[model samples]
Target: MKGLTDRQQEILDLIKSNLENNGLPPTRADIARTLGFKSPNAAEQHLRAIEKKGFISILAGASRGIILNTEEALGIPVIGLVAAGGPILAQENIEKRIPQAHNILSNKIDYYLRVKGDSMVDVGIYENDLIGVNKKNPIKVGSIVIARIGEEVTVKTLESISSNQVVLKAENSEYSNIEINPEKDEIVFEGTCVGLLRDFS
Candidate 1:
């Protein structure tokens, strides 16, 4: 992670600042203009170096592909645990509830659920990120939600629901879709993911 010159550090700083302010990184053209580079190639070179050092990831062909390897600090509640399998801290399992600062959303968030797996990474909700959940049901079909199945709690996208079955989809295909029969099992929608907080350690 060393070997980055001062100019490269400045580029990294610019990217970080942009993410904090705009929720996304700047484009190559933006960097080139800000740094007084005559051509976008200069910005691209720095970006490649940063990516090589493993501090940032450059998404090929993406308009805004810069993603900081580490994120800024955000104060959020560290809930006990939500199982990726047959485990979710059922209401009865919660023994401690500490208030946390919400950097993304300020109102109506009931609790924060710390993500624990790669099941939702394709959508940029990585492991250890805190998702702001609201008990209020989302009025749309594609809402990302926190759901409870029996005793396990999982975060998934609500793909579709019917009188016969509820389909909970994972953004990452590695995790199979969760299909529940409303008649056979009790699948409860705890809350919708209103905000994403990627405050890394």
Candidate 2:
């Protein structure tokens, strides 16, 4: 890949490192504050230069919209919430970042999130476990994921028992399975879980 100028690369490094460590890109003000610039506009100038050089993409009109152009995009999709009555990824209530890997995550997806529920305890994912996800799908069987049903979010293991029915199974018995018919209900698969992380420290 083409290399960036020293200052440009330094700026890029800051943004990339922030996303890697914090699970979200930094805002212009954040970049300026970190680099000790006189104003956020100074950081913005550097970012625009980086974007012009094809090192990153800036989501206009949105705060903290920077995205890395490298493999990090495939690293994880943050689990935000569990769908109603389901045990997996729920779109409506998503709240955190989950880290997975490229091979397991779908392309051009969003960040990962931390899971919160005992429904999936049997699968080794306790409350506060991180789950990765992809935005694109034809989600496969046995994939852990986030789903959206009506207005709630939940986490669960996904199971495809038939051509028309999709099942979301909880890892623990304290929860029940959520079955949906794609042809009738408004249930939607938000993303697939691709990675896991535990904070033991």
Q: What is the TM-score of each candidate against the true structure?
A: 0.53, 0.50
Q: What value of lDDT does candidate 2 attain over all alpha carbons?
A: 0.71
Global lDDT of each model?
Answer: 0.78, 0.71
Model 1: colliding residue pairs: none
Candidate 1 wrongly placed segments (more than 4 Å): 1-77, 82-107
Q: In model 2, state the lDDT of residue 152.
A: 62
- Tens-place lDDT per residue, model 2, 1-201, is 566889888899898789778988988889888989979999999988888877788899988888777545443335454444744444554454334444543454565567766788888887776555555756777978777766566677787646578898988988788998877776776777665667786
Clashes of 2: 28
Q: Candidate 1, overall lDDT?
A: 0.78
| Lowest lDDT block of 10, candidate 1 | 70-79
**Deviation from native of the Cα of residue 5 in model 2, angstroms:** 21
RMSD of 2: 10.4
